[model samples]
Target: MIWWAVLGAGLGCYLLKLAGLSVPPAVLAHPVVSRVADLVPVALLAALVTVQVLAAPEGGALALDARVAALAFAVGLLWLRAPFLVVVFGSAAFAALLRLL
Candidate 1:
């Protein structure tokens, strides 16, 4: 069941990526489409961040925890224009300290 779910997700992602590449340059250059396209990455990143930071396992519940703090720190670093590697390492370090405490 898990394998099937993974395969389905991979296939869906591939299809979406292919869809982006398949669009003709002229179509992408259209003012409306271009504006929407520019927003796609930001929207996708927001969605991804939301899922990682907000979702919980089993039944739905809300809690303030170290993982959440780490996520917030990472987002702050991103807002400050920190390099990708620094954000990743800093988040990992923060999470580790939290876990140790």
Candidate 2:
């Protein structure tokens, strides 16, 4: 039963993607649609990061801890145009140091 549901969901997602591809190019070329297409990935990534950093272990409440602070630090580095490697390692090291203290 679970496998069937999983297969059904996979098929549904494929069909949804196909539907998106089938949209007329004219529709996609619309100014609003084009702008939204550009912004959607950024919005989704931000939402994903926010949820991962703020969600509690039990998923029942928001959390504000070292993870959130580390995220802030990473954002600050990014604002300063830091390199990707530096941003990642700097954030990880900051989080570790926070947890230690």
Candidate 3:
């Protein structure tokens, strides 16, 4: 069952990648499609981050943690227009220190 799950996941990923390559540039460049496509990655990343930072092991409810703190700091830095790398490393360091404490 686990192997089947893994295989299915792999195939799904491959199909998505294949679709990415197979989709014509013209179709992607259409105004409406382009806007949606541009937002898709950000939306997906937001969902992924939300899950990683908020989801609990037993699936009861979201809880705060050092990682969430780091994410908040990172968002603040971005709001302040800090450089990208600075925001990333600053958040990572903050999370590490928080974890240590």
Candidate 4:
């Protein structure tokens, strides 16, 4: 079952990519499509981060705690225009410290 799921997912992803490539270049080049495509990564990243922050460890109840603190710190760092590496490590360290307390 797991193998089937993995194969299906991989094939589906390839099909999606192929479909994207098969789209007419003119349509892809349209201003609205280009703007939306540009925002897709940002939207996806935000969703990913939100899920990670809100998900509970060990499949337990969802609740805010140290992870929220880390997310807050990361957001603050981003607001302050700190470098990407600093933002990531700082958030991780902050969360670890919170967890330890």
Pairwise TM-score winner, candidates 1 and 4: 4
Where in model 1 is the C-alpha error above 4 Å?
1-25
- What does candidate 4 score on TM? 0.92
Q: Compared with the true structure, what per-residue lDDT tens digits does model 1 show for residues 9-72?
A: 9999999999989988999789999899789999999889777676676548765577799998
Q: Residue 1 in candidate 3 has what lDDT?
A: 92
State the displacement of the C-alpha of residue 88, model 2, in Å, after optimal TM-score superposition.
1.6
Point out the higher-scoring one by lDDT: 1 or 4.
4
In candidate 1 the C-alpha lDDT for residue 33 amounts to 94
- TM-score-sorted candidate list, best first: 4, 2, 3, 1
**Candidate 1 has which clashing residue pairs, if any?**
none
> Candidate 1 versus the native: TM-score?
0.68
Q: How many clashing residue pairs, candidate 2?
A: 0
lDDT measured at residue 61 in model 3 versus the true structure, 0 to 100:
85
Model 3 per-residue lDDT tens digits across residues 4-101 = 99999999999999988999888988999989988999999999998988877678888788988999999999999999999999999999999999
Query: Residue pairs in steric clash, candidate 4?
Result: none
lDDT of 2 by residue, 17-54 (tens): 99999999999999999999999999999999999999
lDDT value, residue 32 of candidate 4: 100
lDDT of candidates 1 onward, in order: 0.88, 0.98, 0.93, 0.95
Candidate 4 regions exceeding 4 Å error are: none
Worst-scoring 10-residue span by lDDT in model 3 = 55-64
